[model samples]
Target: MAVKSKSVASKIVLTALVLVAIFPIFWVFLNSFKQLVDIVSTTPKFIFTPTLDNYIYVLGRDNVQHGLFNSIIIAGLSVLIGAVLGIPAAYAVARYPNRFSDDIQFFVLSLRFLPPVAVAIPLIAIWLDLGLYDTRTALVITYTLLTMSTIIWLAIPAFSRVPREIEEAAIVDGYGPYAVFFKVALPVAAKSLIGAVIFSFILVWNEFLIALMLTTSDAKTLPIIASEFTLLGRNVPWGILNASVIVLSLPPLIFVGVMSGFINSALKKKD
Candidate 1:
């Protein structure tokens, strides 16, 4: 009975920790449903009626359809580039763990540490000179570099965790290196690869800094559009702002929830 009590206590504490971690997301969601008068109210308004007015206003905007389209296009293209580049690169690194491969992994990770703002200046200049400024291609190339580093980082582990003996056995049975990689290694690591790609998609989708600077009116993203609310007058359209934010936030949230479930199921199946 005493041991059972200890386990219960532990569960309670863990539950509290999880709630703390998720509180900010909960706060955003709760406020998104509240009316503007209640959103920043001095007193908490948890008991108030919820409204979809904010969401309707944001989604109903003129350029929003275009922005949404652009976001989907850029994010999808970025994921494709990351998968193409990172998968082979990671497979090579895992298959041959030489100093060069290790250095390559290290170099890929180094890209993350570089500030976006610092890179954006030169990138903007180069894009302008190349006549690629404010174009979808610019977004694609930058997002490729932005997302692929992390995707490669995640892919390397998935590849390395697969036993080399499995690949060797397949190769010995007449399968080529590529066949062994695709037929054996990738099938097993599909869950991790899928999870990593989903994560990369979320990162590119939510990215603001590069998108803000790289894209003007022609190719502005959701995040960039969200920032436009702040430039409004004092009596701002609160409903529209909150509505826009909620919609903007939904894609990544749903992506994580759906992909996480699949990943969990995949891991269970593997077990």
Candidate 2:
């Protein structure tokens, strides 16, 4: 009876947490289908005629498309760059556990806690001096700092989880370090690496502060573009804004669904 009660309690907690996480997103989705009048009504209306005008207007804008394209490019490239650099660095730190490695790990982890404004303030000055401000390249570089730090830190545990014996055996079999990493260590740690990639992609996709400061027009992202709906005039276009939010959120949702198995598997495995 106690066990059953505990199980029920756990389920209730999980359900509540899920609802809390999903409610805002569901509200925004509902707003997206509503008319401007319906959205801004004094009281929330559960029953209302849905329309496609909000979506139509949001999608027809060239800035929306441009911002989305930039978001995709920036997030995708940031994750790619993060993976390329982080995987090797993580492997090194895991392989060599010493003072130097400890220092590197501390530095990498420290980046995660650093405030965005702290990094963004100096980055703006440096970017301006280098003539890279307001460019995709600048955003890409700035976002790499965000994604790469996360990748390197998260990937450490994944690499550490890989058995050293397997790597040693591969080396004895005449496989080079590169081959062992690609064939043996990587395969063993692929689940965690995939998790890192997924997380990094989401973080980069939703990042706004640096993009807002650095990008004026050319490199503006979906979040930046969505935010502009509020800044257009005194009255916020809630319907159009919600439509943009829904559109912007779809890719991350789809990516997570596609990678759910990997994420679940990684979570189940001991680190």
Candidate 3:
């Protein structure tokens, strides 16, 4: 009876926590469909006529479209570049424990720990010096630092969890180092690696500080454009802003939803 009681209580707690976490997102989603007056109403009308005007207004802007495109390009390229560089480095750190490996891992982690402003200040100067400021190329390269560190940190454990015996067996079958990594270790760690890449993608996608500091027009991201909605002074377009927020959130959510199948299959394999 006590165990059953405990289970019920735990489930109740988890349900409450889930509701708490999702309530803000649900609220925003609801408001996105509302008229501006409905959204700003103090009474918080639960029943109102829904309109597509908010989405229409938000999406019709050229800047919003360009910012969306820039976000996709920058995040995708940064994650791709980071995965190519960091995966190999992670494999090395996991498989070969040299004297410097720990130091290298620590250094990578320390980069993540530093405040964004600290890193952005120096990068701003460097990009300006190279005449690369306010360019998508600059954002991609700058975001690579964030993505690479994330990939290396997360992928180290994934690679470490891969069985060494499988790698050794591949070696016995006359596989070269590169071949073993590509065929054996990589396949085994594909699930976790995908997660690392997705996380890196999301990090770069939602990143506002560095993007704000570095970009003016050509390289502005979705988050930057979202913030621009607030510059309308006192009568902030709450419905339109919420609509933009929903749009900003769609890509990562879709990416995760798509990749969920792969993650499930990986789990089934491990089981």
lDDT of each: 0.84, 0.89, 0.91
Q: What value does the lDDT take at residue 53 in candidate 2? A: 96
Compared with the true structure, the alpha-carbon lDDT of candidate 2 equals 0.89
Q: Write the per-residue lDDT of candidate 1 for residues 47-69, one digit (tens) a residue.
A: 87988877776677777877888
Candidates sorted by lDDT, best first:
3, 2, 1
TM-score between model 3 and native: 0.89
For model 2, residues 1-271, the per-residue Cα lDDT tens digits are: 9999999999999999999999889999998999989988999887899999999999999999999899999999989998999888998888877779888988998888888988888988999999999899998988898888899988988898888899999999999989998999999998778888888899999888889888888889999999888886788888998999899889889876646875676567564
Winning model by TM-score = 3
Better of 1 and 3 by lDDT: 3
Pairs that clash in candidate 1:
54-243, 55-243
Clashing pairs in 2: none
Which runs in model 3 stand beyond 4 Å of their true positions? 1-15, 255-271
Candidate 1 overall Cα lDDT vs. reference?
0.84
Regions more than 4 Å wrong, model 2 = 1-18, 255-271
Q: Give per-residue lDDT, candidate 3, residue 252.
A: 80
Against the correct fold, how does model 2 do in TM-score? Answer: 0.87
